[model samples]
Target: MNDFSPALYEVLYVSTLATDQPLSVVAEIAGRARIANAQLEITGLLIFDGQRFCQQLEGPKKQVLKLIERIRNDPRHTNVEVIHHGPLAGRRFQHFSLAFSTVEDEDALARMEQLDGSAALAAFENVCEELEL
Candidate 1:
């Protein structure tokens, strides 16, 4: 029996939205991401403020890497920072979604900030471990 597990890659990207870009702009970007995810079999979460976006993408390692490279080359974003990345034991998100919220939505912002933090990554690992996915 083949014991090899599928490689899972996770990346956290932070990018600035163009100044005065409309909400429709974000929607367009999210629409593109959704299409890419569907085509690539990637799953993850996208979070955005009016002017910035932070997202996590997890999937087969090679595919995720290719997707990230494409995202870097895309002109829709500037100042993209890859905050976290590595092989994940399992997927963090079961499907792709663009979850929109404002900075004024303090609780939501705080949750996303936590996910972006070092501590939460460890916690995420623990959760994945417990779930045994």
Candidate 2:
């Protein structure tokens, strides 16, 4: 079987950074992503802690992949990890935003981090399976 589905769909993922970067820096990166998304017809959400950032990008597969590539190559982030990636049945966010939340705040970081790696990969696959994407 092919690794990617034949249907046209969106890609979603979360990226994390180290605990040393400032919120302003993260905001700037989010802003740039927003502009880029606008130009590319993509939409998503971005959350930032004082030190790290998490984002969910949804758009055409190729566009989302290009955006992910740019984000991964960006020098501003340290520990950029993909939390989830697959076809989103619908867009969760209308526009790209830089959301700010504290790492110590409740289960924000834990929740996002929980969706990383194999767990998240499985979750995305399940979503595709259930939704028939």
Candidate 3:
């Protein structure tokens, strides 16, 4: 019989536009992130509120942590913080390696704000629910 490894998930936080990154540049960043994540089999979603960035990554623990280390050293973003991390029964983001979305709806923004500070992971789930992606 063969054995398999369990999956782990992690959530990362970074200051939004804290580096004064323009939308075009952020798009570039997202593109790069998607590429790297795909190569490492990382799956997750990146959420933005024009104020900050919150991302959830799910995969094998070793790969997930390694990718996170690279993200911590990335100069394009600051205040890199890992807010939530642990083993997961399954990957929440199984469809995309790196999914990017923005909160443009006023009401959605309010709902997300309510999840921040003490509810970051939940906030990620909420954003996914709203986007259906």
Question: What is the C-alpha lDDT profile of model 3 across 38-113, one tens digit per residue?
Answer: 8777788887776666677877789888888887887766767776677777766677888888866535444544
lDDT of 1 by residue, 1-133 (tens): 1125367778877677766566688888777778768677677766665666767787778888888888788777776777678878866566433333334442442344445556546533443343322
- Candidate 3 residue pairs in clash (backbone atoms < 3 Å): none
**Winner by TM-score:** 3
Q: Which residue runs does candidate 3 get wrong by more than 4 Å?
A: 1-6, 105-118
Runs in model 2 lying further than 4 Å from the true structure: 1-12, 18-21, 95-107, 117-133
Q: What is the lDDT of candidate 2?
A: 0.58
Model 2 over residues 1-70: C-alpha lDDT tens digits?
Answer: 1224333345445555645655567666766766777776677655554555566666678878887888
Mark the regions of model 1 whose C-alpha exceeds 4 Å error after superposition.
1-5, 97-133
Q: How close is candidate 1 to the true structure, as a TM-score?
A: 0.70
Is candidate 1 or 3 superior in lDDT? 3
TM-score of each: 0.70, 0.66, 0.77
**TM-score ranking from best candidate downward:** 3, 1, 2
Model 1 misses residue 16 by how many Å? 0.4
